[model samples]
Target chain A: MDKFSLFVPNFLPCREYFDPGNNNACPGCGLALGVRHVYKAADKAMEKALWENISDTKFFGIKTNPSLLKIKQKKNELIICLDNEAGGSLRDALKKQMPGMAVAEGFKYVATACPSYPFDLYDKVKKALDTEGKSYIHILCPCPEGWQFDPENSVKAGFSAVETLAFPLYEAVCGFYTLTVKTAKPKKLSDYITIQGRFSGVTDSEIAEAGAIVDKEYSKLLEKIQSSYSYTFETTGKVY
Target chain B: MEASSGFLKKMIKCSLIEEGTAKPYKSGAHRKSLPEWDRDRCIKCGVCYIYCPDAAVYRLDDGFFDVENQKCKGCGICHSECWFGVISMVEER
Candidate 1:
């Protein structure tokens, strides 16, 4: 049974899982954007690592596992990649369960408005990974498909979202989390809403209300990063 | 084709706005009380004729653009492209 708790997982991330013609029409679904972004990020990371260590490391093909539970035998490095859905929460529970594995949670990896992982939840997972000497990179990919926008507007929406603090762009290293791009104050939520079709139902007044929610959330996240504390490394030197 | 000296109007479909709303001819700028048609001022350059995307402008045998005002979407393609700036897009409101 799929456990549903604090985290939500986009279990079906593969294009093959999608039927050519389905009865359910999810035109502005953000989950699809999250899957595509994760796949792209994985490819880029592997390529960068390979180029950096051409002589020392060999390129190996990756197999997609339903659950990323396999322990690295000799390399002593285990990477767990998950979306910001129930599956990600399950992974977080597993991290609490297994002390030997390191977990990295992706945030806003796909949708401009909908972040992959809850920003607060991501903070905790990122804290755990850093203490283990593991690297955590949060990807924020905006999707015009998810936003119900003209497909061409994806890149513009993506940039605006970051600048507006509708989505925060930053990296967490070790125990320190810093905002790479800072906005003095969150921009009007309408600036983020009118461009996309998913939020087309949103009115000018409702837009103001939604903006308040976004601003409150962004403020809380900023406060958390500003006052971050050092986290204890949980996993033993089983692999390291 | 049967040629008429009077205005022959047609409607175009645009998903962006309300359907079946008959907009006046390019809407009502081509009617009289607008301006004098100076044939000498016009070079018969065919700029307006070639520039209208909707084919709303046609050159008559008399060496002038016969603009089908009702058929024009007011897209301003002709007005902007005209080297002589003879064509203008008036406000619909």
Candidate 2:
């Protein structure tokens, strides 16, 4: 892990993932952009962690230890070797899975989003992909069609979301909680919703009530961030 | 040569696409605008490349960035992200 410091932010992976096909997502689609960003972050995480937890199998030659990447508490007596890459079973020989060799849980990833919070988005995703447990990064992606906002203003929508405390950027890792983005002066919830047609029907009083709810949520989150309290297993989601 | 009558040749019945390929030419057509890059203003920060959803902005061997016009959806994300104002989104005529 100490090798991580050698990584300079200027040094980004130019290697492209094998994109099987072009996406048919609508232009200015927030979901598409979110997926694209997540893909990039995960690719960079894999490329950066290229040197971590690598072992060899008798047949598979050189391969990453799946258990190390996965945070399962079970201790399997798996033999590891540096030279096993020399004769391991072809990993994708059938390019499929076998039911008999399955883990109790299927593969899953933590999910999260917003474009205004790109730095926050990238950081959280990279952490999620690199970390021990199932971590999720929640991004506030604005849809033009659904939100009734102009496509050009999609990015602005994201900005307004964070600015208004409609969505607070955060990450919870190893029972340690932290707010990634702290809005010094949160804008009005009305400001967050005024642009979107979906919220056009919302009355000012109702908006105020929502703002009160946001304030309560934000303060509770702030408490978590301030206290160095390490929560036990019950505080977080099930990781099995 | 034709196979012998008693012999059976097996082949995949489904279409198989070669992996790890990108087709920028197709989506490049439906775009409404294109990004223009200013070489002088660029700091080579790789920010443009990072923010572009299509991965159209690529860094060159000389450490400068350029766009793959066909693949770019002209979303203007690169234009918006460039700190040096090196990228400008120009409407397609």
Candidate 3:
């Protein structure tokens, strides 16, 4: 299959974050390993989506964040948008390199690897990208390996992330927003912390602090869902 | 003919079962061949546990070491952790 058929734009692949020599990693950082897994999974997903239609797929990279521009429709093409939390400055740097090119006029969809935490900020970013109609936005989160948690607790972390607001699972199209909520309760962060080495030094009080932040964030998400129309998304899988 | 059969019996006595748990020798001079465990010298620090990617040596409820001979690939991590020579890796008798 022609794997890169969607003009797949990549931010930074996860492997870089886990390199032992990177020095940025803590002794027990599970998040680094988790990120590597998720990136591989996401890549597989995108690849599957592209290869399934290889006969007509045309992959491209904008090398710019979707926030900066209104993407003009290109005929018979699937565009992939990518960004990381490292900062928006890198996107600006890319735009500056192409002095005449602006980001606002470029992307149709944006995908984020970061969890949607502190929902207010997530909303502002979503609004910036949804300007040209409803767009595909994804927030992939609660990575067990990344957060220094057990690999199995990822789903629990996912719910905690959304419920506590440390992460929110939602998609926004145009001005419409829908929050994804599963019936399961968020598991204790302690259960998640034991498997990973990163949180080894975190004190109980600090964990409590993290919990409060998550709780506040989740409350906001629930409020948003109750106030807006809800839609269920059933279609998700690796595409290549 | 009697001597040949006796020699065969001795050889059979020395043989190990195909899949039984390997343990320290029950008695006699051959017992010294087993790996030594000096608990007083052990700090119970668990470096042997952490560095053991295979997780061969694990802690027991009574707070002692337990070896899984079947699972152990005979990696020298336990031997390496014994700075005071509490544990040693030895060949099977």
State residue B28's C-alpha deviation in candidate 3, in Å.
47
Please give the DockQ score of every candidate, comma-separated: 0.02, 0.17, 0.02
Clashes of each: 12, 15, 29
Please, what are the lDDT tens digits per residue for candidate 1 over residues A1-240? 122421122222222222212212122223333333333233323322211222332212333222221112222222333322232321131122111111223221111122333233234333333343333333344444444565324445655666666666554443334554556665665676678666656567766666666667666656746564322223442211
User: Please, what is the whole-model Cα lDDT of each candidate in the order they appear?
Assistant: 0.39, 0.55, 0.39
The top-ranked prediction according to TM-score is 2
lDDT of 1 by residue, B28-74 (tens): 33222211134666666654443232334555777566655544444
RMSD of each: 20.4, 14.9, 21.3
TM-score of chain A of each: 0.45, 0.61, 0.39
Lowest summed lDDT across 10 adjacent residues in model 2 chain A is found at A76-85
Candidate topping lDDT: 2
Cα misplacement distance, residue A107 of candidate 2 (Å): 14
Put the candidates in TM-score order, highest first: 2, 1, 3
Off by over 4 Å in 2: A1-9, A18-21, A44-115, A227-240, B1-25
Q: Each prediction's TM-score against the native?
A: 0.36, 0.61, 0.32
lDDT of 2 by residue, A71-146 (tens): 2222211111111012222222111121111111221233224655555566666655555533433444566676
